[model samples]
Structures are given as structure tokens and as C-alpha cells.
Target: MDRRRLTARALAELADVTVVSLSQIKTGKQVPQETTVQRIAGALDYPVAFFHGADVDTLPAAAVSFRSLSSVTQRERKAAIAAGGIAYLVADWLHSKYTLPSPKLIDAGAERDPATAARALRQAWGLGEKPISNLIKLLEAKGIRVFSLAENTKNVDAFSCWRNDEPYIFLNTFKTTERSRFDAAHELGHLILHKHGGSNQGPQAESEANSFASSFLMPRADVLSEMPRVQSLQQILRGKKRWGVSAAALTYRLHKIGLITDWQYRNFNIQLRTDYGSSEPDSMQRETSTLWKMVLDDLWDQKLTRADIATGLNIPHGELENLLFGLTAASDRPPLRNDRPALSVV
Candidate 1:
């Protein structure tokens, strides 16, 4: 029901069963017959074997750091959580085949401020105030599994959560590249600053994540050295490209760091609102997953296609594609030799 976003009545109707029967089965009050299980699986487009598999771990709604929690509907939230469950299966499959990087994130929940936390993470990672060339690659190298969210809606920008000592981030590729980068950084903040608990903190968590993203993407020293005085919107537009952030974000960062006065900040914000209400101008190219590209390429060498992966996971091919959409370097690129050990499973 969660995977298909179906209610009991809807699922029962599709499966040619009564709602009471479905509810009883769901509540463990009655056992479902083999024919009933087959009908339910058929209705949900999942294999019968999928229903018999061991129980899968599911992400709790309170644990997921949703960018816009208030705007997300219950159905949408369920679907997103279901997607995370599927992502766990995919990650497990990858782990069984190849060795992956270990989690390198630090717990920053005790930090006094988001900026300080961001800087600490940067120093720990040995980034040294340099503009990250590819934020997605950086996250993956740090053992953060990055997946694309197929929601394709503005309500769900991105989300992140930790499962079994590993971090996972899901990005909504429907937004501009600049926004997506910020979203990635924002989720990173949640992972470190609120690792134990913060998703339920509401506005406070979101605000800290935003500040962390701004500081992480555009370091205080780097922004000061690059653009000390922002006189006009054009300066912001030109400077934003270096940090891969939106003009509004750059303006806010400048104001926060005292590089720009409150009056100037207000004026610039008004101008930005007039020009680009909810969209970014001159956005950069979206970042793809280098780790996923390498994984797919390695699998390709063993004559395993994406369809094979979906079948192995007992999921639809489209579901796997949705999680990986726009994440690979190319769809038809030839396989390359991988340095990792050979797959343990065919």
C-alpha cells in the first residue's frame, strides 16, 4: 500500500477483495490465502515472491529530514519512505557485490552554530576552504549514498536519513542545478548536526540546515576574498557561479557575514524577487553520481543490465531507473575496467 500509494479500499477493489478482508489480513487477524496474495501482488505490480521475502526495514517519518515537511502530503510522504526502503535493498545488493566507502561524517549536534559545524566538517574532510568541484561526488566519496528522488514536485525538494550506521541522501532532480546542490548540502547538515534527532525540530532544523548549506557551499573566507563588496545584483550573479548557489542565497550569505548592509540586502532581495520569483537564472549543470556510474559500469562488464538489477531486487525496472535517473554519466557509455575486487555474486 505504501509503495503503490494505495488505500485499503483502493487496493481491495483492485485485488477483487473486500476492504474488511484486506484490513483483517493487514492487521494479522486473518491469514491471506495463496490466491489472495497473488491477486494483491498483481494489483501492486510486485512479484509474488516479493511478498514472501523477509521483512524489509522502513524509514520512520520522524527520522527523515524532509525539506518541506508541512507541504508534503501523507500519501507523498509514504511513497517517499517506500522509496527509501527500496534504496536500502539496492544499497545492500551493491554491498554484497563490491566494497564501498565507510561513513566519514561526524556528529555535530553539540556545535553552537551551523557555520561552526560546517567549518568543522570541512576541516575534518581536508577541504581547506576550496570550492567543491562536484558536491555529489564529494558526498559519495565520504560514504553518503546519493540517490535521485523521483517525486518530480516542488513540495519534496530532498530528504536524508541514517540507517544501519550509513547515511543516505535523496535529491529531487526536477529543480535547478544550483538549488539541488544547496539541497544536498542542507541534507548533509541534517546528517551531521542532527544525526541523533532533529527532523522533528520543525523550523529550527530547517533554518540550521539552510545556514549550514550556505556556509558549507560558500565559505566565509572564500566569499569575502572573492566579493568583498556587493554593489549590485550583477555582482551576486557573477559570484554565485563560483559557489554554485542561487543569487538569493549568495545575497543572504553576504548579509549574514556583514559584507552587505541590511538595506542593501533588502534592495537586492526585492530586485531578485522581481526578476526571478522561484527560479534561478544561469543555473549550472546538475551533478551526477560518480559512484553509481562506476558501479553500473562494473556491473555492465559482467553482462548485467539494469533490468537484471531490478529483477534481483524483486522490483520494477522503472523503480530502479527512477532512483538512478540523471545520476549516471551516460546511458550508453561503454563499460570500463574497475579496480575493485570482482563481484562475489553473478
Candidate 2:
């Protein structure tokens, strides 16, 4: 509720509780009763079980790279942060159970030019000007944990952070496939170019992330070589599939790289606005978590379920569903309560 910027009085009113009671709950002076919990859950659109467990701390402001503050409300941002914390714990637990990919990125925060940083990372990753087929799969294989945001608010484009020496990226799956792809690269840029750069929320940081994303997705050499002599939106759309980017993104990149004139770029933008509105028309399949999927499948084979994972982590099943983002087939079914106590090696 604090992340939502809801005052105690307002939340109490919404939950049909007294402000003093809510204040007491906040201060840990009093535990919420069952009726209060149900009312609060209904008001917040969260599960009743979520209130039973203690809330987890979100990633620090400086540690996260939001695509834009203007895009999401404080409530949405805080919700994403809270979701990110759960993602981190889930990834951490999965890491212990399986041999996941390790981070292969080097810090490029000192690099002044974002494009240079993007190129350096491409070189480091051995991804020569070749178009990446699947951004999520590549990131997963490279040891960057990626998850889809379950909030469905559509305000958060995407955000990335590093916690406990591991990098995580969360994309708003509610957005277009093209937008989601760009968001993935944008967050990747943050992970590599802004490691430990905390709360990179200014125009400079956003510009850098955009540059990194542009170059990272559409390399200069490869994209330029294939560029059309005449400005053609259709041609670009056909080619965008090769780079797995959106028409608008390719148009901007072309203009940025001097492949197209400013007039042509503006004209293309106008056309995009008319044709696609705020979205692109494509049938690209939404990216799912490969690492988590594998882990869940293995657990299923072993008769261990998402419920088991949730119980082990002391997180609510609803919260776990948000983290898993339908990637886990077993998430739909109720998690079987494990009577065995969680194992701890001291």
C-alpha cells in the first residue's frame, strides 16, 4: 500500500477498517484479523494468502533501471519491484537445484558511448552482426534471468536489476511482441552497461539504454548492409523480422544511423501512428521462460510442484504464479501442501 502511495486513512477506508488499525498493522503493533485481511486483499486485488506472509523487500531504486518514469505510476513501479524480488528468490532457488547459465557480461558503465558499449557486449558475446533469433532464449543461455511481468498494468515497459550477484530482467508481456523485444534488449543494456549504477532514471540513462538497445538488436554493419536505398516502410517491416524488431524501432534506428533522412523518418512515424496506433500487428509468439520451464518440468517428473517451491520459499501461491507467469504448467492447479518441513543445511 505504501508503494501504491496509499495513505493509511485511504487504505483503511477502502478496506473498511479504521485508520488506527491500519496504522497499527503497518507499525507491527497489531496483527491483521482474517476479516481485515480479506477486505484488504479484495481492495488491493491481491490474494488473501499474500498478506499472511511477510512482504519481501524490493530492489533498491539505484539497482533498478526503469524504461521511463513517465510511463508508469509509482504504484505500478512499486508493484514491479515487489514482483522482481519474488523473481529473484525463485531464480535463486532454481539455481541451487539446477545448473543454470552463468553471467557472461562485463561492466561497461564507464563507457561514455552507449553504442560502443553495445558493440563491445556483442563482440564479447560473439554475436557478430548476426540478428538474434530469440532475445529471451539468448539471455537465459547467457545467465541473465528473464521473467514476464504479471501485473498487466501496461505502464511498466520493463525493468532490470542485479541482486545477490545475479542479474534479472522483467518484461511487460502485455505489450506488443516488437515492444517486448526492444524492452528485453533495453534491460540487457542496463544489466551490462549500468551494473551497480542504481536508480538510473534520468534522460541520460534512458538515452543510453535506447542507444544500447538499438545497436544491440540491430548492429550497424549488418543492418546497414541490408538497408534499402529508398525509404520503404513495407521493406523495413519485412526486414524487421530478420532483426526481430518493430517497424517503429527500425525506422528510428535507420534515421539515427543516417540511413534515412529526418523527413523520411517523420513520415514513417506518421504512417506508423496511423497504421498501428500504439501497437504493432504481428503473430510473433510470446517468449516464455526456458530455464524455469525446464526446472518446473523436472520437478513435475519428480512429483515436486510449484506448491512445493512456494512453500520452500515461504511465498504465497498467487505471488508465485505472478513470478512464474504461466510458464509453469502446474501453476493453474492448486499447490499441494507439503507436510515435510523445509530442509536447511547450516
Q: Which candidate wins on lDDT?
A: 1
- RMSD of candidate 1 to true structure, Å: 2.6
Tens-place lDDT digits, model 1, residues 81-119: 899899888889888887788899988984459999999
Alpha-carbon runs more than 4 Å astray in model 1: 197-200, 327-333, 336-346
TM, every model: 0.92, 0.85
Model 2 agreement with the true structure over 208-294: per-residue lDDT tens digits: 889999999999998878984745788778878889888888888888888899899999889889988877756467777666666
Q: What value of lDDT does candidate 2 attain over all alpha carbons?
A: 0.78
